[model samples]
Target: MTELGRFGVWVPHTEVTPAQAREIEELGYGALWLGASPGADLPGVAELLDATETLTVATSIVNVWATPAKQVAESFHRLESRYPGRFLLGIGAGHPEITSEYRKPYDVLVEYLDELDAAGVPRERRALAALGPRVLKLAAERTAGPLPYLVTPDHTREARPLIGPNALLAVEHKVVLDADPVRARQTARPRVEFYLDLTNYVTTLRRLGFADADLAKPGSDRLYDGLVAHGSAESVVKQLVRHIDAGADHVALQILDDDSLSTLRALAPLLREIP
Candidate 1:
């Protein structure tokens, strides 16, 4: 299995360019996680891979309902042949609202994995956007491990035991590099609001012990503080470290902002120094 260094950046493929991708590599981020849904062919993944050497590029997830497994596997093979160890395929069963045919997600994901296996996409070369015990176990048994999104260090602590000692637990965390508590929450709330509308996220948050009020629209401040690390770069690094201490093999940092490059560049120095 390819080691996805300790820290990575999660950004939308549409928002990042080849030049920017190269800069991110230079900035020392281990991997670049591209966010995509259905109909995403992942041409940008190839473009980013071509622009940099050594940095691993992974799809945060390719929605199973949006793209056929055969097509995704074909793309994975083509990219793997060209880039070799620099590409990791991250796939997931998206939300019920977004996927009209969303039902029996676990079974569907297993079928997709079967297709990838048939197409020769090695289990070690891929990861799953998994939450909950069943899916997390499946990720460990089938792929690299779960790449859980919008989770706290506590969740990481709980999840590590479920996936066991071998599987890679790459957790995604959102951060805001602002010192002011109000401004930080202001920046973080919008993203939380968006996820609050998604039932899957709400369910996961609830499982993490957040109250119903915390999962409410706009989300409670306590929930925001738990989910997003806001304040100085050092403080944010501390939050990332907590996840690592909780058994996370890698942490994908998602900056809440329109211009992610600036935030990434700003946080790079501090993140690179994380042991």
Candidate 2:
């Protein structure tokens, strides 16, 4: 299996053009994770793969509730045939608040995995957007591993044991490159606020030792700081390294701003220092 490199970047698919995709590859990012709930036909993924050589493209999540399992599997086969080892199929059972039919998510995910298995979407090339232990263990047993979002190093430390030693632990960390504490928090609070409405995220944050006060609307400074690394590129690298040290195989850095191409370009030299 081709390992996901130590560092990668996660950006919304709609925000990334083929030119920017190529720029990401040129900047030395090993993987480009598309943060889209792309149903069935993931043309954006194909577009990205076509734009760059040796750069892996993965769906941050293709929600199972919105897209049929067989359709997703078919899309995976189509991409894998053309892109070969460069496509990773990441599937998830999204939050209940947004999904009308979000009952028994664990069972639904397992059934979806079953469909993918039947359709010959290689297990090694698939990943799960998991946060809790049950789903994380399922990710280890059924697919490549869990691609946990909005997680801290402590979560990574705890998750490593449940997923065991072999499965890939790809964790997403948010970053803001600003030295001023007030400005950095200003950039981070809105991003954190977006996740607060979702029950899954709130539950996960609580599990990570955040109190009810911390998970409040606008969120506490402690909550925001824990979830996002804000400072110089070097400071962002330190937070990312914490996850790696906590047993994460891959850390997908998400820059909390509109202009990610410039952010990735600026952080490239500092990120390359990680082995």
Q: lDDT for model 2, please.
A: 0.88
Reference-based TM-score of each model = 0.97, 0.98
Model 1 regions more than 4 Å off: 38-40
lDDT score of model 1? 0.88
Encode model 1's per-residue lDDT on 17-134: one tens digit a residue. 8898899899989998888562446767888999999999998889888888888888888888999999998999989988776799999999999999998999999999988989
- The whole-model lDDT of each prediction reads 0.88, 0.88
lDDT of 2 by residue, 231-270 (tens): 8878878988999999999999888866767778888998
Error of 2 at 55 (Å): 0.4
